[model samples]
Target: MSLAAPSETAPTTDSKVVVITGTSSGMGLAAAVAAAQAGWRTVATLRDPSRADALREAAVDAGVELDIRRLDVTDEAAATALVDAVIADYGHLDAVINNAGAGHLGTLENETVADVREVMEVNFFGVLHLSKAALPHLRASSGRLITVSSVGGVIGQPFNEAYCAAKFAVEGYMESLAPVAAALGVTVSVVEPGAVATEFVNNINLDRDAEVAAAGAYAPTLRAYLERTAAQFLNGAQTPAEAARTVLEALTADTPAFRLQTSDWARDFTAIKLTDVDGSAVLGLTGTWIG
Candidate 1:
Protein backbone atom coordinates (compact mmCIF):
# COMPACT_ATOMS: atom_id res chain seq x y z
CA MET A 1 0.00 0.00 0.00
CA SER A 2 1.27 3.45 -0.86
CA LEU A 3 1.48 6.00 1.92
CA ALA A 4 -0.26 9.33 1.43
CA ALA A 5 2.04 12.07 0.24
CA PRO A 6 3.40 14.36 2.95
CA SER A 7 0.70 16.87 3.69
CA GLU A 8 1.38 20.43 2.72
CA THR A 9 -1.77 21.97 4.15
CA ALA A 10 -1.73 22.82 7.85
CA PRO A 11 -4.14 20.66 9.78
CA THR A 12 -6.95 22.51 11.51
CA THR A 13 -7.52 21.80 15.20
CA ASP A 14 -5.83 22.59 18.45
CA SER A 15 -3.43 20.22 16.72
CA LYS A 16 -0.79 18.79 18.99
CA VAL A 17 1.79 18.00 16.33
CA VAL A 18 3.94 15.02 17.31
CA VAL A 19 6.77 13.52 15.23
CA ILE A 20 7.69 9.92 16.03
CA THR A 21 10.77 8.27 14.54
CA GLY A 22 11.21 4.57 13.52
CA THR A 23 7.54 3.97 12.86
CA SER A 24 8.01 1.23 10.26
CA SER A 25 7.23 -1.32 12.95
CA GLY A 26 7.22 -2.05 16.69
CA MET A 27 6.62 0.62 19.36
CA GLY A 28 7.15 3.46 16.90
CA LEU A 29 4.30 2.20 14.73
CA ALA A 30 2.07 1.61 17.73
CA ALA A 31 2.91 5.01 19.22
CA ALA A 32 2.07 6.78 16.00
CA VAL A 33 -1.35 5.11 15.88
CA ALA A 34 -2.03 5.75 19.58
CA ALA A 35 -1.08 9.39 19.32
CA ALA A 36 -3.41 9.88 16.37
CA GLN A 37 -6.22 8.19 18.25
CA ALA A 38 -5.54 10.58 21.12
CA GLY A 39 -6.22 13.51 18.75
CA TRP A 40 -2.70 14.53 17.82
CA ARG A 41 -1.58 15.25 14.28
CA THR A 42 0.95 12.45 14.31
CA VAL A 43 3.84 12.49 11.85
CA ALA A 44 5.16 8.93 11.74
CA THR A 45 8.63 8.69 10.17
CA LEU A 46 10.87 5.84 9.16
CA ARG A 47 14.13 5.34 7.28
CA ASP A 48 12.34 3.59 4.46
CA PRO A 49 8.77 4.39 3.56
CA SER A 50 8.57 1.17 1.47
CA ARG A 51 8.75 -0.77 4.74
CA ALA A 52 5.76 1.14 6.16
CA ASP A 53 3.07 -1.23 4.92
CA ALA A 54 2.55 -2.63 8.39
CA LEU A 55 2.20 0.80 9.98
CA ARG A 56 -0.27 1.89 7.35
CA GLU A 57 -2.29 -1.33 7.64
CA ALA A 58 -2.44 -0.99 11.42
CA ALA A 59 -3.55 2.62 11.24
CA VAL A 60 -6.23 1.69 8.72
CA ASP A 61 -7.35 -1.23 10.85
CA ALA A 62 -7.65 1.09 13.84
CA GLY A 63 -9.43 3.86 11.89
CA VAL A 64 -6.78 6.50 12.50
CA GLU A 65 -4.65 8.50 10.08
CA LEU A 66 -0.91 9.17 10.23
CA ASP A 67 1.10 11.70 8.30
CA ILE A 68 3.77 9.21 7.36
CA ARG A 69 7.09 10.60 6.12
CA ARG A 70 10.54 9.31 5.31
CA LEU A 71 13.22 10.17 7.86
CA ASP A 72 16.59 8.54 8.38
CA VAL A 73 17.78 9.75 11.76
CA THR A 74 21.37 8.85 10.90
CA ASP A 75 21.41 11.36 8.05
CA GLU A 76 21.82 14.78 9.61
CA ALA A 77 20.50 16.62 6.57
CA ALA A 78 17.47 14.37 6.24
CA ALA A 79 16.77 14.68 9.97
CA THR A 80 16.88 18.47 9.84
CA ALA A 81 14.84 18.63 6.66
CA LEU A 82 12.15 16.31 8.05
CA VAL A 83 11.63 18.49 11.13
CA ASP A 84 11.63 21.64 9.07
CA ALA A 85 9.11 20.16 6.66
CA VAL A 86 6.87 19.02 9.53
CA ILE A 87 6.74 22.50 11.07
CA ALA A 88 6.41 24.11 7.67
CA ASP A 89 3.50 21.87 6.72
CA TYR A 90 1.75 21.69 10.08
CA GLY A 91 2.48 25.22 11.25
CA HIS A 92 3.48 23.98 14.74
CA LEU A 93 5.49 21.23 16.36
CA ASP A 94 4.68 20.11 19.88
CA ALA A 95 6.48 16.83 20.57
CA VAL A 96 9.39 14.83 19.17
CA ILE A 97 9.75 11.12 20.07
CA ASN A 98 13.29 9.88 19.53
CA ASN A 99 12.44 6.22 18.98
CA ALA A 100 14.74 5.46 16.05
CA GLY A 101 17.27 2.92 17.36
CA ALA A 102 19.12 -0.25 16.46
CA GLY A 103 19.98 -3.10 18.84
CA HIS A 104 23.33 -4.84 19.21
CA LEU A 105 24.47 -7.91 21.14
CA GLY A 106 27.88 -9.46 21.88
CA THR A 107 30.83 -8.55 24.09
CA LEU A 108 33.08 -5.62 23.28
CA GLU A 109 35.86 -7.98 22.17
CA ASN A 110 33.54 -10.00 19.92
CA GLU A 111 32.20 -6.95 18.09
CA THR A 112 34.30 -4.69 15.89
CA VAL A 113 34.75 -0.97 16.57
CA ALA A 114 32.83 -0.47 13.33
CA ASP A 115 29.96 -2.48 14.82
CA VAL A 116 30.00 -0.34 17.98
CA ARG A 117 30.10 2.87 15.93
CA GLU A 118 27.16 1.75 13.74
CA VAL A 119 24.99 1.06 16.80
CA MET A 120 25.95 4.36 18.41
CA GLU A 121 25.26 6.21 15.18
CA VAL A 122 21.69 4.97 15.16
CA ASN A 123 20.91 4.66 18.87
CA PHE A 124 22.84 7.59 20.35
CA PHE A 125 23.75 10.13 17.70
CA GLY A 126 20.42 9.68 15.95
CA VAL A 127 18.68 11.00 19.06
CA LEU A 128 21.14 13.87 19.18
CA HIS A 129 20.55 14.78 15.55
CA LEU A 130 16.76 14.74 15.73
CA SER A 131 16.57 16.33 19.17
CA LYS A 132 18.92 19.16 18.26
CA ALA A 133 17.06 19.80 15.02
CA ALA A 134 13.67 19.94 16.73
CA LEU A 135 14.66 21.91 19.84
CA PRO A 136 13.93 25.33 18.42
CA HIS A 137 10.52 24.29 17.15
CA LEU A 138 9.88 22.47 20.43
CA ARG A 139 10.95 25.54 22.39
CA ALA A 140 8.61 27.71 20.38
CA SER A 141 5.68 25.51 21.35
CA SER A 142 6.89 24.67 24.89
CA GLY A 143 6.84 21.08 23.61
CA ARG A 144 7.76 17.61 24.81
CA LEU A 145 10.93 15.66 23.97
CA ILE A 146 10.62 11.94 24.70
CA THR A 147 13.22 9.31 23.88
CA VAL A 148 12.66 5.55 24.23
CA SER A 149 15.56 4.25 26.27
CA SER A 150 16.03 0.70 27.57
CA VAL A 151 16.27 -0.71 31.13
CA GLY A 152 19.79 -1.69 30.08
CA GLY A 153 20.56 2.03 30.14
CA VAL A 154 20.55 2.00 33.94
CA ILE A 155 21.78 -1.59 34.42
CA GLY A 156 24.23 -3.37 32.14
CA GLN A 157 23.78 -6.97 31.07
CA PRO A 158 26.03 -9.62 29.53
CA PHE A 159 26.71 -9.34 25.75
CA ASN A 160 24.93 -5.98 25.50
CA GLU A 161 27.90 -3.71 26.11
CA ALA A 162 27.55 -1.56 23.01
CA TYR A 163 23.76 -1.36 23.11
CA CYS A 164 23.82 -0.54 26.80
CA ALA A 165 26.50 2.08 26.28
CA ALA A 166 24.38 3.86 23.67
CA LYS A 167 21.29 3.75 25.88
CA PHE A 168 23.27 4.94 28.88
CA ALA A 169 24.47 7.85 26.77
CA VAL A 170 20.88 8.62 25.76
CA GLU A 171 19.77 8.62 29.39
CA GLY A 172 22.65 10.88 30.39
CA TYR A 173 22.17 13.27 27.48
CA MET A 174 18.48 13.71 28.21
CA GLU A 175 18.93 13.85 31.99
CA SER A 176 21.47 16.63 31.65
CA LEU A 177 19.29 18.48 29.13
CA ALA A 178 16.01 18.05 31.03
CA PRO A 179 16.54 20.79 33.60
CA VAL A 180 17.75 23.30 31.04
CA ALA A 181 14.88 22.45 28.67
CA ALA A 182 12.42 22.77 31.55
CA ALA A 183 13.59 26.30 32.13
CA LEU A 184 12.30 26.99 28.63
CA GLY A 185 9.04 25.01 29.26
CA VAL A 186 10.02 21.90 27.23
CA THR A 187 9.60 18.75 29.29
CA VAL A 188 12.10 15.99 28.50
CA SER A 189 11.49 12.35 29.43
CA VAL A 190 13.14 8.96 28.93
CA VAL A 191 10.99 5.81 28.75
CA GLU A 192 12.73 2.59 29.75
CA PRO A 193 11.12 -0.69 28.72
CA GLY A 194 11.99 -4.25 29.67
CA ALA A 195 11.77 -7.23 27.30
CA VAL A 196 9.24 -6.02 24.79
CA ALA A 197 8.38 -8.69 22.20
CA THR A 198 8.99 -6.76 19.00
CA GLU A 199 11.18 -6.71 15.94
CA PHE A 200 13.50 -4.71 18.14
CA VAL A 201 14.48 -8.02 19.71
CA ASN A 202 13.97 -10.24 16.66
CA ASN A 203 15.92 -7.85 14.44
CA ILE A 204 18.97 -7.50 16.72
CA ASN A 205 22.05 -7.56 14.48
CA LEU A 206 24.02 -10.25 16.29
CA ASP A 207 25.67 -13.45 15.13
CA ARG A 208 25.58 -15.56 18.30
CA ASP A 209 27.53 -18.48 16.89
CA ALA A 210 30.25 -16.16 15.62
CA GLU A 211 30.34 -14.30 18.92
CA VAL A 212 30.51 -17.50 20.97
CA ALA A 213 33.29 -18.90 18.75
CA ALA A 214 35.29 -15.72 19.20
CA ALA A 215 34.78 -15.72 22.98
CA GLY A 216 37.56 -18.34 23.57
CA ALA A 217 37.20 -19.07 27.33
CA TYR A 218 33.99 -17.01 27.50
CA ALA A 219 32.11 -19.28 25.07
CA PRO A 220 30.16 -21.25 27.67
CA THR A 221 29.09 -18.13 29.53
CA LEU A 222 28.06 -16.41 26.30
CA ARG A 223 25.92 -19.39 25.31
CA ALA A 224 24.31 -19.51 28.74
CA TYR A 225 23.54 -15.80 28.64
CA LEU A 226 21.88 -16.21 25.24
CA GLU A 227 19.72 -19.07 26.49
CA ARG A 228 18.68 -17.16 29.61
CA THR A 229 17.78 -14.10 27.52
CA ALA A 230 15.61 -16.24 25.22
CA ALA A 231 13.80 -17.62 28.27
CA GLN A 232 13.15 -14.12 29.58
CA PHE A 233 11.48 -13.19 26.32
CA LEU A 234 9.26 -16.24 26.50
CA ASN A 235 8.35 -15.79 30.17
CA GLY A 236 8.09 -12.02 30.55
CA ALA A 237 7.68 -9.63 27.67
CA GLN A 238 5.43 -6.65 26.98
CA THR A 239 3.59 -6.16 23.70
CA PRO A 240 4.62 -3.29 21.44
CA ALA A 241 1.18 -1.78 22.03
CA GLU A 242 1.72 -1.82 25.80
CA ALA A 243 5.12 -0.19 25.34
CA ALA A 244 3.56 2.41 23.05
CA ARG A 245 1.06 3.38 25.73
CA THR A 246 3.91 4.40 27.98
CA VAL A 247 5.17 6.70 25.24
CA LEU A 248 1.69 8.11 24.78
CA GLU A 249 1.34 8.76 28.51
CA ALA A 250 4.66 10.53 28.54
CA LEU A 251 3.54 12.74 25.68
CA THR A 252 0.19 13.75 27.17
CA ALA A 253 0.71 13.76 30.94
CA ASP A 254 -0.23 17.01 32.71
CA THR A 255 3.14 17.04 34.45
CA PRO A 256 5.37 14.58 32.69
CA ALA A 257 8.16 12.79 34.57
CA PHE A 258 11.85 12.86 33.72
CA ARG A 259 12.00 9.06 33.50
CA LEU A 260 9.34 6.34 33.06
CA GLN A 261 9.55 2.55 32.88
CA THR A 262 6.91 0.84 30.72
CA SER A 263 6.22 -2.04 33.10
CA ASP A 264 6.33 -2.76 36.84
CA TRP A 265 9.09 -5.22 36.07
CA ALA A 266 11.04 -2.50 34.32
CA ARG A 267 10.48 -0.15 37.27
CA ASP A 268 11.68 -2.79 39.72
CA PHE A 269 14.66 -3.64 37.54
CA THR A 270 15.70 0.00 37.24
CA ALA A 271 15.03 0.49 40.95
CA ILE A 272 18.11 -1.61 41.65
CA LYS A 273 20.24 1.46 41.01
CA LEU A 274 18.17 3.78 43.19
CA THR A 275 17.94 1.19 45.99
CA ASP A 276 21.66 0.48 46.06
CA VAL A 277 24.11 3.28 45.44
CA ASP A 278 27.13 0.98 45.37
CA GLY A 279 25.84 -0.60 42.09
CA SER A 280 26.62 -4.04 43.48
CA ALA A 281 22.99 -5.19 43.34
CA VAL A 282 22.71 -4.92 39.56
CA LEU A 283 26.26 -6.08 39.05
CA GLY A 284 25.63 -9.17 41.14
CA LEU A 285 22.47 -9.98 39.15
CA THR A 286 24.23 -9.54 35.81
CA GLY A 287 27.11 -11.64 37.10
CA THR A 288 24.74 -14.54 37.65
CA TRP A 289 23.89 -14.51 33.91
CA ILE A 290 27.53 -15.18 32.97
CA GLY A 291 27.91 -17.95 35.53
Candidate 2:
Protein backbone atom coordinates (compact mmCIF):
# COMPACT_ATOMS: atom_id res chain seq x y z
CA MET A 1 0.00 0.00 0.00
CA SER A 2 1.35 3.45 -0.97
CA LEU A 3 1.49 6.10 1.73
CA ALA A 4 1.10 9.78 0.93
CA ALA A 5 4.06 12.05 1.45
CA PRO A 6 3.89 15.29 3.51
CA SER A 7 3.50 17.46 0.41
CA GLU A 8 0.70 15.20 -0.96
CA THR A 9 -0.83 14.50 2.45
CA ALA A 10 -3.83 16.74 1.77
CA PRO A 11 -6.22 16.52 -1.15
CA THR A 12 -5.22 18.58 -4.15
CA THR A 13 -7.81 20.72 -5.95
CA ASP A 14 -8.31 18.09 -8.63
CA SER A 15 -8.84 15.20 -6.23
CA LYS A 16 -12.26 14.35 -4.81
CA VAL A 17 -12.11 12.14 -1.72
CA VAL A 18 -13.92 8.81 -1.89
CA VAL A 19 -13.68 5.80 0.42
CA ILE A 20 -14.23 2.27 -0.90
CA THR A 21 -14.44 -0.92 1.13
CA GLY A 22 -13.64 -4.61 0.43
CA THR A 23 -10.99 -3.58 -2.08
CA SER A 24 -8.67 -6.53 -1.51
CA SER A 25 -10.12 -8.04 -4.66
CA GLY A 26 -13.06 -8.01 -7.03
CA MET A 27 -15.14 -4.91 -7.85
CA GLY A 28 -13.95 -3.08 -4.77
CA LEU A 29 -10.38 -3.27 -6.00
CA ALA A 30 -11.29 -2.11 -9.50
CA ALA A 31 -13.56 0.64 -8.18
CA ALA A 32 -10.78 2.01 -6.00
CA VAL A 33 -8.42 2.27 -8.95
CA ALA A 34 -11.15 3.67 -11.18
CA ALA A 35 -11.95 6.32 -8.62
CA ALA A 36 -8.31 7.33 -8.34
CA GLN A 37 -7.82 7.37 -12.10
CA ALA A 38 -10.94 9.50 -12.32
CA GLY A 39 -9.07 11.94 -10.01
CA TRP A 40 -10.55 11.07 -6.65
CA ARG A 41 -8.52 11.14 -3.45
CA THR A 42 -9.38 7.47 -3.10
CA VAL A 43 -9.23 5.72 0.25
CA ALA A 44 -8.95 2.03 -0.47
CA THR A 45 -10.15 0.27 2.66
CA LEU A 46 -10.22 -3.41 3.61
CA ARG A 47 -10.48 -5.52 6.76
CA ASP A 48 -6.79 -6.38 6.50
CA PRO A 49 -4.44 -4.04 4.63
CA SER A 50 -2.03 -7.01 4.24
CA ARG A 51 -4.18 -8.32 1.38
CA ALA A 52 -3.91 -4.98 -0.43
CA ASP A 53 -1.29 -6.16 -2.91
CA ALA A 54 -3.74 -6.43 -5.79
CA LEU A 55 -5.25 -3.04 -4.97
CA ARG A 56 -1.81 -1.47 -4.68
CA GLU A 57 -0.66 -3.01 -7.94
CA ALA A 58 -3.78 -1.86 -9.75
CA ALA A 59 -3.30 1.69 -8.49
CA VAL A 60 0.32 1.67 -9.57
CA ASP A 61 -0.45 0.31 -13.02
CA ALA A 62 -3.09 2.99 -13.41
CA GLY A 63 -0.39 5.53 -12.36
CA VAL A 64 -2.52 6.78 -9.48
CA GLU A 65 -1.91 7.08 -5.74
CA LEU A 66 -4.35 5.80 -3.10
CA ASP A 67 -4.69 6.26 0.65
CA ILE A 68 -4.96 2.70 1.80
CA ARG A 69 -6.72 2.34 5.14
CA ARG A 70 -8.00 -0.47 7.38
CA LEU A 71 -11.72 -0.51 7.89
CA ASP A 72 -13.86 -3.40 9.03
CA VAL A 73 -17.37 -2.31 8.08
CA THR A 74 -18.85 -4.62 10.71
CA ASP A 75 -17.48 -2.42 13.46
CA GLU A 76 -19.58 0.67 14.12
CA ALA A 77 -16.87 2.38 16.11
CA ALA A 78 -14.27 1.71 13.48
CA ALA A 79 -16.58 2.99 10.75
CA THR A 80 -17.04 6.25 12.63
CA ALA A 81 -13.34 6.57 13.34
CA LEU A 82 -12.38 5.95 9.73
CA VAL A 83 -14.81 8.57 8.50
CA ASP A 84 -13.52 10.96 11.12
CA ALA A 85 -9.94 10.33 10.12
CA VAL A 86 -10.78 10.86 6.45
CA ILE A 87 -12.40 14.16 7.28
CA ALA A 88 -9.45 15.18 9.42
CA ASP A 89 -6.88 14.13 6.82
CA TYR A 90 -8.51 15.65 3.76
CA GLY A 91 -10.14 18.57 5.58
CA HIS A 92 -13.52 17.56 4.09
CA LEU A 93 -15.20 14.24 3.53
CA ASP A 94 -16.88 13.42 0.24
CA ALA A 95 -18.39 10.09 -0.82
CA VAL A 96 -18.28 6.64 0.75
CA ILE A 97 -18.76 3.41 -1.21
CA ASN A 98 -20.10 0.57 0.94
CA ASN A 99 -18.81 -2.49 -0.89
CA ALA A 100 -17.67 -4.71 1.94
CA GLY A 101 -19.85 -7.83 2.03
CA ALA A 102 -19.71 -11.61 2.34
CA GLY A 103 -21.75 -14.33 0.65
CA HIS A 104 -23.50 -17.23 2.43
CA LEU A 105 -24.52 -20.53 0.76
CA GLY A 106 -26.94 -22.36 3.02
CA THR A 107 -30.67 -22.83 3.17
CA LEU A 108 -32.45 -22.13 6.45
CA GLU A 109 -32.99 -25.70 7.60
CA ASN A 110 -29.45 -26.80 6.75
CA GLU A 111 -27.79 -23.96 8.66
CA THR A 112 -28.14 -22.60 12.16
CA VAL A 113 -29.88 -19.33 13.01
CA ALA A 114 -26.45 -18.01 14.00
CA ASP A 115 -25.30 -18.60 10.43
CA VAL A 116 -28.02 -16.31 9.19
CA ARG A 117 -27.15 -13.66 11.77
CA GLU A 118 -23.51 -13.68 10.69
CA VAL A 119 -24.55 -13.08 7.09
CA MET A 120 -26.79 -10.20 8.13
CA GLU A 121 -23.98 -8.73 10.20
CA VAL A 122 -21.66 -8.44 7.24
CA ASN A 123 -24.00 -7.85 4.30
CA PHE A 124 -26.62 -5.73 6.04
CA PHE A 125 -25.32 -4.39 9.33
CA GLY A 126 -21.91 -3.61 7.91
CA VAL A 127 -23.48 -1.34 5.31
CA LEU A 128 -25.64 0.22 7.99
CA HIS A 129 -22.71 1.06 10.26
CA LEU A 130 -20.67 2.64 7.49
CA SER A 131 -23.58 4.49 5.89
CA LYS A 132 -24.71 5.88 9.23
CA ALA A 133 -21.20 7.08 9.98
CA ALA A 134 -20.78 8.84 6.64
CA LEU A 135 -24.23 10.41 6.23
CA PRO A 136 -23.49 13.66 8.04
CA HIS A 137 -20.27 14.35 6.14
CA LEU A 138 -21.92 13.41 2.85
CA ARG A 139 -24.76 15.77 3.62
CA ALA A 140 -22.35 18.64 4.17
CA SER A 141 -20.54 17.97 0.91
CA SER A 142 -23.66 17.01 -1.07
CA GLY A 143 -21.79 13.84 -2.01
CA ARG A 144 -22.75 10.37 -3.10
CA LEU A 145 -23.21 7.30 -0.92
CA ILE A 146 -23.28 4.23 -3.08
CA THR A 147 -23.67 0.57 -2.15
CA VAL A 148 -22.83 -2.55 -4.16
CA SER A 149 -26.00 -4.60 -3.91
CA SER A 150 -26.88 -7.71 -5.89
CA VAL A 151 -29.74 -8.93 -8.10
CA GLY A 152 -30.43 -11.32 -5.22
CA GLY A 153 -31.65 -8.21 -3.40
CA VAL A 154 -34.58 -8.05 -5.78
CA ILE A 155 -35.38 -11.66 -6.70
CA GLY A 156 -34.75 -14.52 -4.29
CA GLN A 157 -32.83 -17.62 -5.33
CA PRO A 158 -32.38 -21.16 -4.03
CA PHE A 159 -29.78 -21.84 -1.29
CA ASN A 160 -29.16 -18.08 -0.83
CA GLU A 161 -31.64 -17.52 1.96
CA ALA A 162 -29.31 -15.59 4.23
CA TYR A 163 -27.51 -13.72 1.48
CA CYS A 164 -30.67 -12.55 -0.28
CA ALA A 165 -32.30 -11.58 3.00
CA ALA A 166 -29.38 -9.28 3.81
CA LYS A 167 -29.30 -7.72 0.33
CA PHE A 168 -33.07 -7.25 0.47
CA ALA A 169 -32.63 -5.32 3.70
CA VAL A 170 -29.87 -3.22 2.10
CA GLU A 171 -31.96 -2.38 -0.99
CA GLY A 172 -34.97 -1.64 1.13
CA TYR A 173 -32.99 0.66 3.38
CA MET A 174 -31.32 2.59 0.55
CA GLU A 175 -34.52 2.83 -1.50
CA SER A 176 -36.28 4.32 1.49
CA LEU A 177 -33.40 6.62 2.37
CA ALA A 178 -32.85 8.03 -1.12
CA PRO A 179 -35.52 10.70 -0.88
CA VAL A 180 -34.75 11.60 2.72
CA ALA A 181 -31.06 11.89 1.99
CA ALA A 182 -31.80 13.88 -1.12
CA ALA A 183 -33.71 16.39 1.01
CA LEU A 184 -30.52 16.95 2.98
CA GLY A 185 -28.30 17.21 -0.16
CA VAL A 186 -26.81 13.69 -0.07
CA THR A 187 -27.28 11.29 -2.97
CA VAL A 188 -28.06 7.72 -1.99
CA SER A 189 -28.05 4.82 -4.45
CA VAL A 190 -27.56 1.04 -4.70
CA VAL A 191 -25.83 -0.66 -7.65
CA GLU A 192 -27.15 -4.17 -8.26
CA PRO A 193 -24.95 -6.58 -10.21
CA GLY A 194 -26.01 -10.03 -11.37
CA ALA A 195 -23.74 -13.07 -11.84
CA VAL A 196 -20.62 -10.89 -11.53
CA ALA A 197 -18.30 -13.78 -12.37
CA THR A 198 -15.62 -14.13 -9.73
CA GLU A 199 -16.55 -10.88 -7.95
CA PHE A 200 -18.76 -12.82 -5.52
CA VAL A 201 -18.77 -16.38 -6.82
CA ASN A 202 -15.18 -16.71 -5.62
CA ASN A 203 -16.14 -15.72 -2.10
CA ILE A 204 -18.81 -18.40 -1.85
CA ASN A 205 -17.78 -21.79 -0.47
CA LEU A 206 -19.39 -24.51 -2.58
CA ASP A 207 -17.69 -27.87 -2.58
CA ARG A 208 -20.16 -29.73 -4.79
CA ASP A 209 -19.94 -33.36 -3.63
CA ALA A 210 -19.30 -32.49 -0.01
CA GLU A 211 -22.22 -30.08 0.20
CA VAL A 212 -24.73 -32.25 -1.65
CA ALA A 213 -23.82 -35.36 0.34
CA ALA A 214 -24.36 -33.47 3.59
CA ALA A 215 -27.52 -31.76 2.38
CA GLY A 216 -29.68 -34.78 3.41
CA ALA A 217 -33.25 -34.63 2.04
CA TYR A 218 -32.36 -31.46 0.11
CA ALA A 219 -29.58 -33.24 -1.77
CA PRO A 220 -31.22 -33.53 -5.16
CA THR A 221 -32.55 -29.95 -5.20
CA LEU A 222 -29.25 -28.62 -3.90
CA ARG A 223 -27.36 -30.53 -6.56
CA ALA A 224 -29.57 -29.15 -9.31
CA TYR A 225 -29.12 -25.63 -7.98
CA LEU A 226 -25.37 -26.07 -7.70
CA GLU A 227 -25.03 -27.45 -11.22
CA ARG A 228 -27.07 -24.60 -12.63
CA THR A 229 -25.12 -22.04 -10.64
CA ALA A 230 -21.74 -23.41 -11.69
CA ALA A 231 -22.80 -23.38 -15.32
CA GLN A 232 -23.94 -19.76 -15.02
CA PHE A 233 -20.62 -18.68 -13.55
CA LEU A 234 -18.48 -20.67 -15.97
CA ASN A 235 -20.54 -19.65 -18.99
CA GLY A 236 -21.80 -16.09 -18.51
CA ALA A 237 -20.34 -14.36 -15.49
CA GLN A 238 -19.11 -10.76 -15.95
CA THR A 239 -15.75 -9.38 -14.83
CA PRO A 240 -15.17 -7.50 -11.56
CA ALA A 241 -14.13 -4.33 -13.46
CA GLU A 242 -17.39 -4.54 -15.40
CA ALA A 243 -19.40 -4.42 -12.20
CA ALA A 244 -17.11 -1.78 -10.69
CA ARG A 245 -17.94 0.53 -13.58
CA THR A 246 -21.50 0.72 -12.35
CA VAL A 247 -20.29 1.63 -8.85
CA LEU A 248 -18.17 4.44 -10.31
CA GLU A 249 -21.17 5.63 -12.31
CA ALA A 250 -23.24 5.88 -9.16
CA LEU A 251 -20.47 7.75 -7.37
CA THR A 252 -19.87 10.22 -10.18
CA ALA A 253 -23.27 10.71 -11.79
CA ASP A 254 -24.74 14.20 -11.50
CA THR A 255 -28.23 12.91 -10.76
CA PRO A 256 -27.58 9.29 -9.94
CA ALA A 257 -30.48 6.86 -10.17
CA PHE A 258 -31.73 5.47 -6.89
CA ARG A 259 -31.54 1.91 -8.21
CA LEU A 260 -28.90 0.99 -10.79
CA GLN A 261 -28.34 -2.43 -12.36
CA THR A 262 -24.84 -3.20 -13.67
CA SER A 263 -25.95 -4.80 -16.92
CA ASP A 264 -29.00 -5.19 -19.17
CA TRP A 265 -29.32 -8.78 -18.00
CA ALA A 266 -29.46 -7.56 -14.43
CA ARG A 267 -32.10 -4.94 -15.29
CA ASP A 268 -34.27 -7.53 -17.03
CA PHE A 269 -33.80 -10.05 -14.24
CA THR A 270 -34.84 -7.58 -11.58
CA ALA A 271 -37.65 -6.30 -13.84
CA ILE A 272 -39.40 -9.58 -13.11
CA LYS A 273 -40.07 -8.38 -9.59
CA LEU A 274 -40.74 -4.76 -10.58
CA THR A 275 -43.67 -5.84 -12.77
CA ASP A 276 -44.71 -8.77 -10.67
CA VAL A 277 -48.29 -8.10 -9.50
CA ASP A 278 -48.07 -11.24 -7.44
CA GLY A 279 -45.13 -13.15 -5.90
CA SER A 280 -45.77 -16.09 -8.24
CA ALA A 281 -43.58 -14.71 -11.08
CA VAL A 282 -40.46 -14.60 -8.93
CA LEU A 283 -41.13 -17.92 -7.22
CA GLY A 284 -42.01 -19.61 -10.52
CA LEU A 285 -38.74 -18.45 -12.06
CA THR A 286 -36.47 -19.40 -9.15
CA GLY A 287 -38.37 -22.68 -8.72
CA THR A 288 -36.95 -23.93 -12.00
CA TRP A 289 -33.37 -23.51 -10.79
CA ILE A 290 -33.83 -26.26 -8.20
CA GLY A 291 -36.61 -28.32 -9.81
Instruction: Count the clashes in each prediction.
Output: 0, 0
Cα distance off (Å), candidate 2, residue 170: 0.3
Cα lDDT over the full model 1: 0.89
Give lDDT tens digits, candidate 2, residues 1-291.
234322124445356789898988988988988888787898889997677777777877878888888888888999999888888777777898999999889888899999999999999999999899888888888989999999999998999999999999999999999999999999999999988766466677667899899999999999999999888878877898998899989988888899999999899999999999889999999999998
lDDT of each: 0.89, 0.87
Model 1: per-residue Cα lDDT over 170-236, one tens digit each: 9999999999999998999999999988898777856778777888978999999988998999999
Evaluate model 2: give its lDDT. Answer: 0.87
The list of candidate 1 runs beyond 4 A from truth reads 1-14
Look at candidate 1 and tell me the lDDT of residue 272. 90
Tell me the TM-score of each prediction against the true structure.
0.95, 0.95
Q: What C-alpha lDDT, on a 0 to 100 scale, does residue 189 get in candidate 1?
A: 99
Point out where model 2 deviates above 4 Å. 1-14
